[model samples]
Target: MWSFRTVLTTALVGLQVAALLAVLALTYFASQNVLLAYAEKLTERVARDTTTFTENFLNPADDAAALSQRLAESAVLGTADRAALERYFYEVLRSRADFAGIFYGAADGSFTFVSRDTSVPGAAYRIKTIETAPVRVVELRYVDPEFRPVSRRNDDADPYDPRTRPWYVKAKASPEVVWTEPYIFFSSQRPGITVAKAVRADERLGMRGAVGIDIEINALSAFLSGLEVGERGSAAIVAQSGDVIAHPRPSLVSAGGDQPTQRFAKLTEVDDPALAEAVASLPGGLASLQPGETRLTRFTAGGESWRGAVRRLAASRTPWVVVTTLPESDILGPIHRVRNIALAVLVAVAAATAGIGVLLARAVTKPIKALATQAGRISEGDFDDVPLPPMRIRELDDTRQAMRRATSWLRERRRENLALTGQLREAGRVLERRVEERTRELAAANRELEIANRNSNMLAHELDHRVKNLFAITSSLVALAARTATTPADVATAARGRINALARAHASTKDATDGTLAAIVRSVLEPYAGLEGFRLSMEGEPVTIRGANVTPVGLILYELATNAAKYGALRASGGTLEVAWRRIGDGCAVELIWSELPNEPVGEGMIAEPASAGFGSMVIEAMATRLDATLQRQLTPHGLRVVLTMRGLEEGGPLHGSAQAGGPAAGHSRGDAARRRAWTA
Candidate 1:
């Protein structure tokens, strides 16, 4: 059997070694995965950047052709004015240096072209005019930067005709803008492509001519040469036919010759063996790539593993793929270095952990053995006090001290046994008094709880009563609306509007004993208060309304507001409504005036009065009866005015003739007739 110290030390060292090994393994694999993902992202980013650059280089030419087509079709820049056309073409060419030429070829073989003369030392513009009206002759005029002609010549030998060019023919055949394949320009003998569009002379006429803009491919090559790929990595732009359009090495984009007839170099024809090999190793080569799709692959190039990504440019008119390749060594180099460092750290920690474990175990066991010897002495009935064994560990030292203290305590307890017996009797008497006092306190608490319970029950009964009242009012409104509405839809609309108004009224008085008259009126009109050209103003002395009267007053306001919105001031432009109130009759009643006026003059008989009372008038009469209020109306030349007198509106006052105060009475009998007359007026 192993000794306790040996077992403890061995367990500690073993656990430490296992944990270190697990951590090392996890780090090694996780780092590899993370680094691999990073490499993939880097490859995709390079390809996307190349695609963006190519699009930027080519988009302008397409835009220019479209703009020029519109201009020509609109007759802004026409062939009738040769000087203006030349100046416009010269400006376009100067503004866009990448454009080799701007030319318009007509159906009758008439040509007007403007091109930059780069063959000379200084800046010069050449305008080639081929007039087919009189005779087929090419006029070449070289002008300075100011557009002043410095030299002019005629070449009858030049056989350039607008009707036979590829740009003209393709544009004429297709109604939309057309792009030609990469080819050598006929005039400049430079490798470029033409973007062209057919122009119609008139809306009813047939095609008259085509406009073409030549974009130099050398600009694209130069842009590609500036991109920074990873170390030992390169990027290239290749067409769908495996022809190299652009490369980091400009010389590789074209065949090694000064001949103007030479075309762009093919992928295999380029000197880059690694790029060619990577492209060949792909699943179906460049032709298999689709627009807006990025594909990543791994292949061996030049005896080295490489990661490559090909992304097709989605926005380009031509089908082109950006190929980016990076060496695998560049990606794995950092991860390998990190793994080596981690291994060294693991070894060092393991050695240190072994040494520390042994020292800890020895330190622990020495104190335990000393504590054990002390315990044995106590078990053998040695109750006398003795000095404790010295220990470095706090727990072991505390045990030795406790043993010494226990031995002394046992000796003293034996000597004081009778004294303890006497004290126990006195403690029992004191505990009994405490129990009696606690009982009395608990009884008082129970009494208070009963009072709180009663209050809660009262509150619940009040809430139940209010909810039932609300449902009763809602049922009455629905029944009344159904009786008067012309259609089922009208019944729903009227009932919903009235109930929403009641809800707003209740919300205004929620958590409050009462609310002011102005607040109640504003709440009912809130929906129409913010409408443009319809002004609403409220002015009052702030007379308070009892809680029971809030809903009644709100309903009356809703009726008046609805009438105004439908046929009164609110229906017209620049309408205004004014609500003013004042305290009346011993400060227990309020008199409110509602006035409406339109901005324009009202002619006599222009405002048509209803033949009979409508639903709104009935609602007003009902709500007035509920409030026990009096209403009177007047129709003046300016507008309609109504006055309302509400009684028993003071707080803590009895509402006269109200059902809540007493039984209902006939206080609103005269007011009902007056309200009807006012509603019809």
Candidate 2:
């Protein structure tokens, strides 16, 4: 007799395993069918395309052969005292639109040619002056009358003696015309195939030799390039000897970089262990030959398995083959994808099953456990507290009723237990009374500590406020002193400027804000705004700083601006003020520059340090220190420039009211007012 939980779990596990096996079986069969279909389709496509392409491109050889025969009979060759033959050949090559070039091989091992230079049109016929034994191309040129280049033959060229050429040899072997393997032309060293025919001169006509047309292999490359296979698929032309002839990847023919070779090599490296071995053993052009049948082969290369097929070319005389490959993973990819999806769903189902199992187990076990607990409690004289579930099985209901009766009988005994418990609780309360009083004392101490902390915070904030206010007042007092001094004419103006400096500093110290240091400087210079000879431009990031810091930086910029307004380039016509700032690492700095215009003759500066520091100078120094900044000032011919660096604020805190406002400093007294007015002026 299995328990309900065990029976349910076993059934669930069995069902899940069965479902997994079923899915796997379906996937396996489906995958096999899909791969078989894919291979068949691929092979059919290869066979059909190869046959169609060959039929379209390859013309009947009889026409070409007869054309060759006619050339041998033409006066051009019959008279062929080299010069006349050269001229005749040149005319023929030029007249024939499809003729890339014409090559005539002699029994003496010398080849002659007259052809249009496709790379250079309208060029004179390139004649080969062959004097070498056999293989060396002597003189190849494209030149006209005076032997001057229509196209001068390249001096260093390989000779292509017609007798040695395979196409010529193959043509002479048979009266029918035929195509030859890709070979370098002796005259140009260019890769191409030659269509040649043996000279079967009639006795009635003076026919000299065989004539061949060397068609550039690139023409076939163009032909093959037009075939568009499916994604990640490609086709190439390979010689019967397995040499890559023409491919979409032209670089494969070159020596250095081997992208095509690497691609093919990768195709050979598929991982379905069986597929990998099959491809390795398979040869090219096997599948496409049969048209309807597919030769499915898989092989391993680079440690992975690949699926591929090969078929023979129908019209190709060179025994060419077309080989195509795809990763086995690609052919059966749908099945794998399906399997993965099924597995994912199975995982979810498994998880859900386990969750349900836990819930079911708990549901069934809880009632039995509750009954046992109640029975134990009843044994311990807790009859009045017997617990009953909301619903129960019929057997459990009977059990509960029996327990209830037992409890009733034990009720008198429970009264005895309750009286004893009451006495024990009274003893406990007496013991806890002293401990509670001690705890209360500790709680009171905590309250006092909390109050002290709050007070300290308030005091600190108040101190910061006052100190900031005091510094501002002092700055205002300095401004007032300067304004009251009307002694030296130059001194008085300077004094007035000092007062303006104070006002500038005060203006920047608004309520509080964030990332507004640049704004503060601009606000300070606002009084000098719209001044004709001076132009003020501000750039760089805006940063927020403590109120204490903003004041000094603002003042420094004001002093610099005032000087520029009075004596620097800003004084000259077309003068401009450019102020820019940026953050450098942990700190930020601003450069205030005044460039003098070419409009006016500027006066020379004192060029010496001041004998005594003015209020403005002192304030700038103090502010720089408080803000932890570096101050630099230079009076160039253009204008006066001042740069100030200041510490920036951290991420979050109380909103800096004045910083963002770019407003005037608030909470100022009357003395501060007079100073601000004079300085702002």
Using lDDT as the measure, the top candidate is 1
lDDT of 1 at 220: 69
| TM-score list, all predictions | 0.46, 0.42
The parts of candidate 1 lying over 4 Å away from their true place are: 1-26, 120-123, 184-191, 340-681
User: Which TM-score value belongs to model 1?
Assistant: 0.46
Write down the lDDT that model 2 would get: 0.55
Tally clashes: model 1.
0
Report every candidate's CA lDDT.
Answer: 0.73, 0.55
What digit string (tens of lDDT, one per residue) describes model 1 on residues 8-64?
Answer: 877877787689778878987897778777778998998998888778888888789
Q: Which pairs clash in the backbone of model 1?
A: none
lDDT value, residue 315 of candidate 2: 49
